[model samples]
Target: MAGALRAMAGPSAQPPSAIRHPPSAIYNSSRPMQLGTYRLIDRLGTGGMGEVWRAEDTKLLRQCAIKILPANLAADPEWKERFLREARSIASVTHPNIATIYNIEQDGDTLFMAMELVEGEPLTKLIERGPMIPLDAVRVATHVADGLAEAHRKGIAHRDIKPDNIIVSTRYVKVLDFGIAKQIGGTTDANLTQGNMVIGTPHYMSPEQAMGRSVDSRTDMFSLGVVLYEMLSGRKPFTGNAVTETLLNIVMHEPVDIAKAAAGITPALADVVRRCMKKQPDQRYADCDELRTALVKSLKEDPKLARQSRIPTIAVREARRLEPEPPPRSAVSSHPAPQPTPAPAPPARGTRAHRALVADDDPATRYILGSILQRYHIEYDEADNGADAVKLLKNREYSLIFVDLLMPRVDGWGVIDYVRGHRGNVAPRVFVVTGVQNQKLSAADQDVVTALLYKPLDIAKVEQLVQKSA
Candidate 1:
């Protein structure tokens, strides 16, 4: 499995420099540039065919996401027309999960589309954090399916549905980059001529798409299935170092069983994923809605099946929904003037320090948590068992506590119950830190815990949690 991942990692891991262009060169050129009265602030991101910008709509007084085709691409009348057609098709489908397009405009050499600016990180960033828990994965997939169902209802198909294009925010999921998406039965002669150019990320491409066959809504389902698989398993189902080999696998090979790859994953969940990933579009779920129904069923059965699955020592991380922070105040302006601002007072000495109590029978887990807390400048107390943790809690008031589920003497759940029952009014927020990935917790008990941080903790994520609690 390691060798397979290593082989498939190369092509997908494009160098940052290769994918991004210098922002100034694209927007600051001597060309008559105005995208429907919106002045470009700066380039936000770029891709192979176009550039996305952070722009201010002077007419509307709002910030919007602006995608622009470069002069060279826009000059090609054939590609230019197809691009406009794609924008129109995407604009026609309206859903909460899909980003809304405000307008399409042309100003001399520049052609661009203005849309909503979603404040969130892409799924790619979330995946980089760690593997997501099954429930969270199901939630995200369901939302995406809702959006796709809307599109399919309108006979529109999103040809590309990969991690890089799906945004995860505190309150919503926004699907972005509908560059290659098309409306079924609405293609022009120009589109038909531009043949054989593949679209979509290689690893997530559906078999029909990879084989250059005609596609439908099922194609999107297959790609999303791959995304869900990666979300839960922390790896793509089919992969290879060479593009041809990867494409070949998607066209002819079957993916490894997800349950086998990730222990503790329910068989029902794995089967649902496999069905959606079937090589033949007809063999897969009829549409996004059907696939979503299967996912919902799988989630409902997960709790029962979880008890039977062998628990793994390694922990699965929940994908964080990043919240946007207020922009920092600027000290200087581009107008060559400096603004004077009062310096903030320093924090009170004792008030700034926070203590966290960590309880775990595993010496390694305790050591890891201690090291992470230290790196974040958090004071911590450790106990080997739940009883020891409760004892320590009685004497010292901790801001946060991390408890392991299975330990000598009193277990983690026992400690939680004791604290909740006896110290109801004053108990500190407890974070149930455990390695048992599939353990079922009663909904009532789950509410008392501030949050659950799985084992194999990423120090950065641990610090983030601690900082948030502080």
Candidate 2:
């Protein structure tokens, strides 16, 4: 796994699959694992099904991607055959925007499939620059939509479509990881696990997919709609404290309107996203082709979109363009411009109703929150654990409380229940803070808490929350 991921930072390209050597050769790995003739150079990415590696096809003398299942999976004969059958079926797909599968091979217990090594950053990383410039986002989506259209034509439905699975290079966008793609009219891989369980990540799955309902190309469209929504909003359409909670949100709620979520996005672009995200498959574009056509047509018809597309990278617009370069300084003033005077500190938390509290096992986290709150002229108290937080809440009322979800005793949830259950009318609004992944909030926490923020907090959003509370 280490060797495979090492290759992701350096992706090398070769000629297309049309001109590649004939397959099959057996070779064991020495230092760098080698299966058959394809010497595993590095691993590119991994998922629930399998992990992909960057390999050097010694016979073809070209670089390619090889996906391999876990050794434990080979013991299950039914699963092994299903993997091979699915790999062969997925290999049939061929498109510029889609990674081409080269060959599937079994060496001892190791089963692998060689494929195209996409040289670029995942859209997930690209989005960290903040919400994308709308046009560049649409252009990237159009490329993926084109690939989906082709797959739909071949009677294949890519069950998983997320920013993590899509690559965006300087020149082009490529869709990847077809391991979960199901054949339209054949044995669908809908329920690989017991009790007819649905496969695919929750953050990007359609409501129907989340509910274990039959999915078609429109299922992929719904996922694509989520990716587009994230690209424009810097956040997924549906998110909760836990995966099950997220799925419930997807099935039961409509996302906040995109226009209100992000500035600079036009009504036309927002409408297109809304249409693609309609919970019912019937409400969405009839098919991938229709979705692709709508995206392209929208891009052409909107003048604002045309100008935005010319910018190329989405991050550039967000991190740079919208703010624009500052004017050249007037050759340093003879006397520095009068220094602004600092404002006087306000009174302590004990004196006001706007008092806030920070609860965490770590003093450093509590300190950071204290610093931010202080700068905002908002006085706040501190609690080292959930018990202390509950004690403070029981005795007094506060305007806000930032508490860690995981702690030694009576964790974040304990404090939340105490305040909501005990304090009721005069309880402070809760702001959950935690480093723990897969944290699930109680129903009462949702109603009582103002928001849930992960550890290594987003300073800007926190400040906004402070201002909102103030």
lDDT of 1 by residue, 87-119 (tens): 876788889899999999877777888889887
Determine which window of 10 residues in candidate 1 has minimal summed lDDT: 333-342
Model 2 lDDT-worst window of ten: 13-22
Q: Estimate each model's TM-score.
A: 0.61, 0.58
The TM-score that candidate 1 achieves is 0.61
- Where in model 1 is the C-alpha error above 4 Å? 1-34, 187-196, 303-470
Error of 1 at 102 (Å): 0.4
Candidate 2 per-residue lDDT, tens place, 370-392, comes to 76576556777888878888888
Candidate 2 contains a number of clashing pairs equal to 4
Candidate 1 local distance difference test against the native: 0.70
